[model samples]
Target chain A: MNKLDNQVIIDRLQAVLGDKVHVLGEPHGLLAIQTESAYILELLAFVKNDELLRLNYLTDITAVHYPLQEKQYAVVYHLHNLFQNIRVRVKVFIGGEQPTIPSATSVWQGANWMERETYDFFGIHFEGHPDLRRILNMDDLDVFPMRKEYPLEDPNRIDKKDFYFGR
Target chain B: MSNRITKITPNNPVFYDNDPQDELITLNLGPTHPATHGVFQNVLQIDGERIVSGVSTIGYIHRAFEKIAEHRPFYQITPLTDRLNYCSSPINNMGWHMTVEKLLDIEIPKRVQYMRVIVMELARIADHIICNGILGVDTGAFSGFLYVMQEREFIYEIFEEICGARLTTNIGRIGGFERDFNAIAFDKIREFLKRYPPVLSEFEELFVRNRIFIERTSGVAAVTPEQALDYSWSGPILRATGVDYDVRVTAPYCSYEEFEFDVPVGTNGDVYDRFMVRNEEMRQSMRIIQQALEKIEKEPKGVFHADVPEFYLPPKEQVYNNMEALIYHFKIVMGEWETPKSEVYHAVEGANGELGFYLIHDGGRTPYRLHFRRPSFINYQMFAPMSRGMLISDAIINMSSLNVIAGELDA
Candidate 1:
């Protein structure tokens, strides 16, 4: 799009989202929208498949963990509107206690696996997922390996003598 | 839940008393599959040749890179990004350094920009060649694989001349390249430019007209442009679906705007289209390399780094001569460099697709969070849908055409 057209879209989005729309860094055409999980599904529905927004593509779904932040986890979705030729980032801040957000599978068919990956990595469940099982990790593995609080395997966790002598 | 799962599997009963119950056949398609570039396994539940359901089993090669970054300095992580997508390591190397430079808000010199472009484009070509070549081999045309490897070896030879290592080319330092291309390397690249077109033509000759290859790939794993974009597929894969969006052109990282090249798009979004798109892309990449070389020639050789001496180690002469430089050198080597307290997502056009590194620095030596946007992992997620109704043989071709390098997939 031309420079003026780009500005108009940005202006409209800014007015719509207000303080929730925090532009990061140099803003090389990435619009990040931070909102609550309650508004996630509605917001996603509005952005995706809408004639104006048309972010019909769900590029990726991942979660970011910030141990020090008050909202401990963030579920990030990268969406691209093929018709509009624009990309937007939808972020939902989830607190530490049983973080969950609505799945975008209804909006974009590709969100199925991306949501599963987010669930696998950060333990943030999609509220209405079809089959929310742990992917990319073994079934019995308890902890979310990508979580900030998940303790890394200690180099000394395996004891050779204990294995051989049956200690 | 167990009953629901059981119901999902088919079952039939008539007058027959002892008929076998239909069940999901679980097959692990390798942490070590020939088609999978590295150690990556996908647990697939199959009904006959069709995949009923599939889940990716990653972390076969998790080296704890983020944790390792916490202990090491910013510069040390360059080598690690190299390992993430070994085929296109320089792009990662340059991308990480650019992120650090952005965090520091430093301006790189014009010549350094040219050098970065050269190295990054070379890596992109190498990655595409292997990816497209392997796609051919997986489809039973082995000649393309050989031709592409020979060319990749030539690319590696140039890389070796520039840096010590070929694949894990830790060639560039923070802000710019580790060293300028020596005369020998320059000559070798020029020779490659001359020799590469014929090799590409020969490789194309083997598969472009072959009826078997065409029949196998032309319509298999067909994804709509909307579907591809929604799934976040980029680079050759995205372009193959007719969307001409390229990170290099749209985002213009590492001075990509200055280079004159075309983003080739395909009409049909299928395995054949993806293959054709990548093939044409390699030619574009060569054009980029040639342009970079011309720019490098016109520009005078000087410092290939930002003036940030603290993050970048001091010159060896200064380290040997001055106490301050010696102390700084030790600190840099020991990874005692202080990182800025900021979050930066630096992305570049990797061979497969958009390779992004989301880094959160805590104003310490270590990063608070490190996430790699692995294109292969995201790209592989589309496999089950793409392979569901296709034959097992076509599924193999689709997997190869997707070019999901397991190193990047599992990491």
Candidate 2:
């Protein structure tokens, strides 16, 4: 199978989404594009089902937290074209207050757990997910631990304090 | 026959309607079950001996490695990588190092790359040995598991000779290995190469044609190619469904493209197919290791690590004797170094699947945000759906075939 060119994929995405697509250029040779949170589901479906750029594989779904940015959370989607042996990353930025985006489960069934994991860590709500819940954290935990605002270590723990170590 | 009538109170309701369709028993399969092999919980709704549906709950051992990575420097993260997939620590270590190298745009030496290939391939063989042997144990062939497990011990001895640790070996550094492989390590690897093949073949013969093993694994929890792709499956499980996507072949990190080996693929994504794929993959890993050994011998000595003074640690003797070496060592250890403000995603063909590191840096001592694309976490997503309507025994075999390590899954 002939490998699909990255430029071709970017062109196809731009043609479909128009100004809504912001091409972030290829990082480490992966075509990365950022779009609004609202267009995530539609853009993903178009990319997966497109005739020329058939990114049929959903490699991963994860989120990054940027506390200082305007849209503080970025939901990162990695899609792989198995036939072409190429991968592209898609990012959808959402506000920190109510980070909600349409779920990719409609397009790919594998997104169910990944979305739950994203929600579990970064508190990004997937609008149409069937069973969105805490995946890798305690059920009663209220804090999104992956957020930049949260301290990496527990502040209440006195075991590792400098005074205890005689510093 | 005389009829015996038992009286029941209204509250007791002894003679309630017992419809098979309505009576589904919920069984908690783990969080501490022997068959789980790790700390995983699957609440299975069973009808008779078959599972009707399953709800999986991971994170029993979640260490929050991503959050922790934000606080640790690039080199300190190697030890943490050791815990992700303890079965294949060298691969995780190499993957993390390669990600950092990608961010720094540092070119590694050819000898360093070949050494990494050798270590990563050995780790892959160790990982597959555990998976296939455990599958035998899951299917009631205990003797084959024991036989293969002994071979795994020899591999561990080689690891011990290399890094002084058996399981969680923090073996290599960011640029390259901390030191060169000694003669003892190479000898042990050679010994492993000479002894393991016949044992692996014997292990395969025990289960390949066994009627009971075939009945238990063949066509059980079979997934279509579309389903496998949709679930983001990678590694042997993904290849079992006839998808020819391998990170090593596609991306070719650590000089894997130079090695000649075939990606073992299977048509049916069933337990049997997964078993066959992993079994064949072990042989392929051995083939890679043999080629790597021959190549490593041809390379010059004492070129284990790259010449990155800022990142790579100096030798202890140099640190003690030289002032500049001492300062550099202190700076690197104290996390007082600068990094480029960039983001890169690097993946390696991990034992379980595509273990990727998506690192975002802001020129800080630590990463701004780091994400581990754990393949076990992604591949294990299909477990609940695949378990639906399968026999309880078959679900156990299916779980073994998935090879979901709790450390990697919960990380």
Candidate 3:
């Protein structure tokens, strides 16, 4: 099994995407690439369809909310090339007000539910998803609960009070 | 008589047209249904017994683990991981620990790695026992389930001897195990190894060639290799599609590279293939455990944990008598230990699939963000599409074969 070199893959991505792609330093040997929101779909398609870099397996589609950043939400995709046993992480930052990116369901069908999950949690809309509905939450619920601004614990619960714990 | 005849003659002009849509009946399988085996709901549009289409609903068991993990410190999250795949909690625990270790760049000792491998493989066997046995039960063969469940009890006894908890065993720590495997624990492990193989074989004999079992599962819910990959299936499910992409082999973690084992694969990717793959995998797991036991014997005893005083807790006696040990223990327990500011994604071949943890820390007491790449959650995505055009009974069998534990699915 010839393992695909991470550096070569990164160089190839940079060469192709030019300044639109920024190499976020490899952490734990996984090549992390930050791409402009506009080129995310193109980059995903290229990586999946590329002969040498057949990153056909979409491991996960998720988003992270960074409340203080200028582009406050990042839609992250983890892609794996099963043949070469290499994985790469692709991230696209979108503004908090209207976080949206093109859906990767077109590339990998597995992205269908994952995109819906991302939407349900962080309110990051995958623009072309066929069914963009709240997946894991109730339909009538009005909040995207995973955003950083929301408190993790229930504020109304009185059983474990701050007065007793001395917060 | 004349009036009745006249009325019948007038009503004879009526005609009717049959609408195909009227025959479709919508059935809700469960948020709580016996066949579902977990808290999952699938609304099926059926034409009598044949399913026309289906929609699945999950999150009935969702506890918002990632949200809660954002508030807890590093060491405190192991219990939460235990709840993800409760049937194979040790794997989840180890996976979480490895993620934190990767971020912190902690190189654990060889003995610690071997110990983890042993516990994780046992958990894997226990998980496969449940999946395969439940698969038999779903196929209406209850005896095989009973036979294998007894074996699972033996495995749990081993876990209890090691960690004092069976189901949600918070078995190991970030650097290594909390305590060394005592003599009794090693004896229990050896005993389990001696006791389990014949029972597993008997369980297999009950199902592998049984006509009824094979007929029910052989061709049901078949997925091609391409489809399996497109859905990002991993672990036994992906191997059942003939991919041969085991994380233990491809990206060796926990010193898996040092051991010798074969990756079992199947061609059809159906319920039967999944059953066979997992069954063979149990044998392979036993082989790995046997080798690990042998390897552990050569290493020195009583050196269970790595020498990471900052991360590992000090012994009780040391903490009680030694002033320096007491302060270190306080700092460690209070979430004040120093750690790196970095991001990492670590994956282990979990019972279901690729269980991964993506962590981002900003030199804080708690992680900035943590995402569990739950295999059950991802693998369950294909259920609806796969369930289309199958009998409701076969669909039940399909769900069992996927082994999507609700706790992991909704995590």
Candidate 4:
């Protein structure tokens, strides 16, 4: 009935999440909150089931590979409450040789393909993903092509040298 | 046994049904089947034509657009978006442009916004025509597909006149259109506007009341509003489930709020309702286009793009003559322009659904990361789950009605 402003939503989130969800400040007006990988599910569950702002729709689940950061991976979730017309972005930073985070498939069934696509591209494993394999690449793809190390152009191509193009 | 497809596998090495009397037959619908519109393989476990389960294998045509976008500059990414939902690429192009514009905080002219609305609504109509017509083809009705496809040519001609290409039309630039609508383009649009209605109504007449069509589609693959929401379904599919959530009305980008049109919804959430909802939305799209044409005439003419010289490519003649224009052109082409560190997610009510671009620009010439929340990719997840109890024919028609464009699906 009342419009759920960012303050009310953030207040509720802070109450339950405490310091886990650090307010990353509104980057482009969407409430982007950062949390550790351990608390992502708790943070996601609270916002989704909260009585006033039931952000029930899982818009998209994607991961960003940040090779330079202390945490090398950031798994992002965009959740929307269609009834209230509000959205909150939940991001969890995880890093290791095998970066894994608790899957959101428990919260949203639609997260299955999204998480699979994320894993396929970023190689960030979802701890409990029902089907965790490549969705958009060959089954035998050895490397995640989206990672920073993987160059777009073929390194072996002699014709594509920057010197040849007069750059 | 080692290669058992408990998860979706590319090839079937072995499949065994323990009970011989009621043994399930494994049927691969396609990585290349006519029923599966775009390239996708659905391995359906069926028993006497009743589907037990289906595992869909996508990614045959995955060009890795997201990977490609990360390496390219903002201006060059339009062609990649053009390929996403090639059926209505102008929307994808505009949506990508709008995302970049949001990052740069560029304000477009009211005239440009109205022009965009016309092109976008036209795309919506073209897309719905292809989809609903294909649904007819999927059903036994062959004549309706032929009749409706004729109208698509006029729309394609309108696009060709505007942007010199059709299908994968990179129709607009950042800030606004590359060029103002020429006289012939407007005339062709006017001609299309006048000609399309009767054909659309006739197409509907053949399918809407046909006892066979109704009986076939009415109760097939029905989903409730709650179920649809759970699957994050958007566009006509979710609308057919009786949810009035449309990104155009809800978020109102590109001055969409200024337009007067209704978001048509359906209650059944079945194959028939999805079909009817798209048909009604096409009518609404026509309404929006008519209003846009009237509204664009009232604005000051010839302002095709926004006034941001920093990003907007200047005319070739100016680049040759002027110093500022030449420097700016060089900076743009070389991807040397400055960008602030920020992340933005912008969604346009694409023909398929809420096609969103999640862009993360970390003070780089190119986006640090860009993720396309493609509607087909998200909505297609529900197909396998929904097809479990239905007959194989119903599953094929259900996939058709959902309008899963593989370009977007495996993007």
Candidate 5:
């Protein structure tokens, strides 16, 4: 296989995705790119099946909750092309209320549990996923715990109140 | 439906009509079956002894390490990492520190790098001993497990000499070790190296060619190369499927590229293959540690950590008389040092597989978001699918071979 770099990946993505793809810069030499949530599946498929840029290995799938931004969540995918020893970070921002994105289970079977874990913590619904449920958290949990709104401390802790602390 | 004798054949008669012949029994394999190494519940649909289907139930021990890491300061997060994949906590500890160092851009000394490789390799050997030893016990060979645990305790002694804990080490600081290796630590390592090989050889002699052990594990739960890769497997299990994708050799963190070691690959991804792969990997880890011991002697003696004063805290003795040391120590302890608003992903060849830390730091004392790409959690995803038509006994061996740590799975 030929050696593939950041520029080659960017150019290939631009040629296929046109205006849908955006380069988020290579932070720490890993090519990070962004695209709309709608085109994520197609873009992932293109890169995985592309002859030269076969980033077939999905290193990680996680989402970050950013409450201050216009788009409150950024679902990140770390994809690695094992042959060339290069990695790419794919990010797509989605709106806060009822956040949903297309699932990549059709592209990679490994996406099943990662998507479930992502849904378990951040509550980003993955459309077309085979199994989507709370993975690490109990099913009785009402709120997504990783969101900024939920405090880490328990609500029933009465002794640590401001009055008790002499505020 | 009465118990009347009816002739079905010339010499056989059927009497009772209460046979549940065509039913598939749903059995709970465990949240705590004595055979299960961890607290994972597999609800299996079995036809007699063979499993028709299975669904894994995890999160029995989930501590939300990621959620906790978001609030804790950088110096306080090492213990949180120690809980993940607890079989190799040093690897997890070093992996997290390397992630922070990648984000902060700290240059480590050669001595520190060699020291890390030695500790991490010893951790790998210890991890394999637990995994392979447990596999031996599951396969009805209990004597080998007892022999290996004795060596594993010596490794724990080495860790205890450096940092005062055995299991959840929390061994190193962010840039490097909290303190330099002592004379006793070096002696323990050298002694462990000399003492471990014979027991390892005995372990191999007991199981490698044994007929019963071979029959139980040779063809059980064999996955093809495509399936292993598609499932995002790493470490020995992936290597057992003939994929030489080791994060140590491929990505080469902690100066792993400098080591002369072999990435052992197996022909078929079966239980036996995984067992042999781990055994060979332990030997290779020993070789790497041996080389690291020799290499450390040539490097500078006193340099245990990097020269980065921002992250590495000053010595307590110097903090008393020297005002500069006092302020630096105070700043580091309180997490007051400046940091860049950078996001980076760093992976280490954990005892099991690629233990990655995806950190997004927003110039805060605590991480904005920290995600641990736990290898056991990902590698065990295909367990249910792979156990479809195997016997219940084979399933136990298969799970042991996978070495799915409960802590990492639920984290």
Candidate 6:
């Protein structure tokens, strides 16, 4: 294997991913690679099994909500290849109203629950999961609590007017 | 006989069917099953004693730790890590604070960092003992379990000497340990080292060569090194598959780079290999403890904490005498310290696996987002592949070998 520098690796990845890679500066030491929903699984598959860059382990899968952005949710995949012993972060952006990303279960079976959990907390749907249901949340839950726009009610501000209304 | 037969006449129709040659049954192994150390449930589709398929049902112990962390102040989360993976509380505490410190770029003193390494390794041994001993018991080697527990008791005593509690030891703060290592605790660890071997040997005697134990575990949950890596298996699970990857050696956090220890790797990724790896790890942990003891004995007067007192709480003596000290202490206690806005991920090689904390701080006392890459939770993904087609008893042993702490899994 060629011993490539970190920049060379990044440049090579950019060459392969073209305009899909969006290097966000806010999250330090992270390369937020943005891709379309349809290409989610393809990018993951290439990362995991690609000869040049074999990122076999899916370290973590999570979703972050940016309420201000045109794409309100970004599903992130942290991948690591034991052979190369390097980790790469992949992010796919999805619109808030109907957030969805292709499932990477076929590429890495470990993504099964992590994707489900991302869905459970942030309501980001995985297009091809075998069972895409509420994981940590109750079945009756109506809201994705982790969303940036999710309403958070103040516990101390409860109105006593409701208590006296029927009285 | 004819009169008895007549008296026992069939009162109901026989459902108009012939008996099936074979029958398959679905068994729900509880959210309270004795086999599951904590509250865990497994819905098993079985054909006689052989399990066809099984689905693990977790979340019975979920405390919504992530949600709770959002509301609590920074220091308060130290005690919460104690609850996440209760078996290895020190590691959890260390991992959490390390992530926060990484975000803040706090530089702890070498002595304090070394102390963290020693205590964390000790906690890892205690955790592995619980896991390996429980696996032994599940395989019907009860004596091995008893012996391991006895050794664990000694480790627990040292923990009690340091902290008021044993099980949930909220030992470390953000910058360093809550208190300096006492002489008594150090003495207790030395005594434990002497007595620990015979106990581990006794367990090895009872199970290592026992044909039944070996047969039950050896190939029951055989996963290749590649498969283990693919599933993000860590600690014993990853090592059992012949991967010499210990995060202490690989990443070296908390000054683990200073320690001289071997990363034990096994030939096969099976339950037996996991057992062997954990046993060898116990030995390695003893080596680390011995080295730490020698170092501490030589230099007992070294400072126990870092220079960053603003990040860490100041001593009570200084707090009362000095106004600046009082304000810094107050700021730390109130979790109002102006921690720089940043995100960092800290990975520590915990007893079970790679325990990582992905902390995102939005220039606040509390973290904006905190995610735990819990080993138990990820390792449990391999259980289905490991247990399918194995006997029900083998499945139980395999599950035990995986060491899926329900608290960590559900958290």
lDDT of 3 by residue, B19-103 (tens): 3556789899998999888899999999989999999988898898999999999999999999999999999999999999899
lDDT of 6 by residue, B1-411 (tens): 232333343784344345563778989988898987888788888998988888876677777777677767778888888987888898898888888778888887777777787788889899999999899889877877887888788888888988767999998888887788788987898898899888888888888899998888888778898788777788888899998878788667876776688888888788999999999999999898788766665654757876787788888898999999999988887877777876666788878888877776788777777778888888887786667798988888888888888888878
lDDT of 1 by residue, A1-167 (tens): 33323455456656766655544423334666677787777777776645556666666677888888899998877666655546677677888588878888877666777788778778998988987887667678788878877766555665655767866
- Each model's DockQ? 0.32, 0.79, 0.77, 0.80, 0.83, 0.46
Candidate 4 residue B216 Cα shift, in angstroms, is 1.1
> Residues B2-72, candidate 2, lDDT per residue (tens digit)?
33237667866544344345689999999999998999899999999999999999999999999998999
Report how far residue B388 has shifted in candidate 1, in Å.
1.1
Residues A1-167 of candidate 5 have per-residue lDDT tens digits of 56788999998888888999999998899899999999999999999999979999988899999999999999999999988799999999998579999999999899999999999999999999998988889999999999978888897999888999789
- Whole-model lDDT values for every prediction: 0.78, 0.90, 0.90, 0.90, 0.92, 0.79
List of clashing residue pairs for candidate 6? none
Clashing pairs in 2: none
Top candidate on TM-score is 5
**True lDDT of residue A32, candidate 3:** 91
**Cα lDDT for residue B200, candidate 3:** 88
lDDT string, candidate 1, B83-108, tens digits:
88888888888888887787777799
Assess every candidate by TM-score. Answer: 0.87, 0.95, 0.95, 0.95, 0.96, 0.92
Runs of candidate 1 with Cα error greater than 4 angstroms are: A1-11, A14-31, A50-59, A79-89, A153-167, B1-28, B35-37, B42-56, B334-339
Question: Which parts of model 2 have CA positions greater than 4 angstroms off?
Answer: A1-3, A162-167, B1-22
What is the alpha-carbon interface RMSD for each candidate?
3.2, 1.0, 0.9, 0.8, 0.7, 2.2
The clash number for model 1 is 4
On lDDT, the candidate that comes out on top is 5
lDDT of 4 by residue, A42-123 (tens): 8778878888779989999998988889999899999898887787888888999999999988888888999999999889
The list of candidate 5 runs beyond 4 A from truth reads A159-167, B1-15
TM-score of 1: 0.87
TM-score for model 2? 0.95
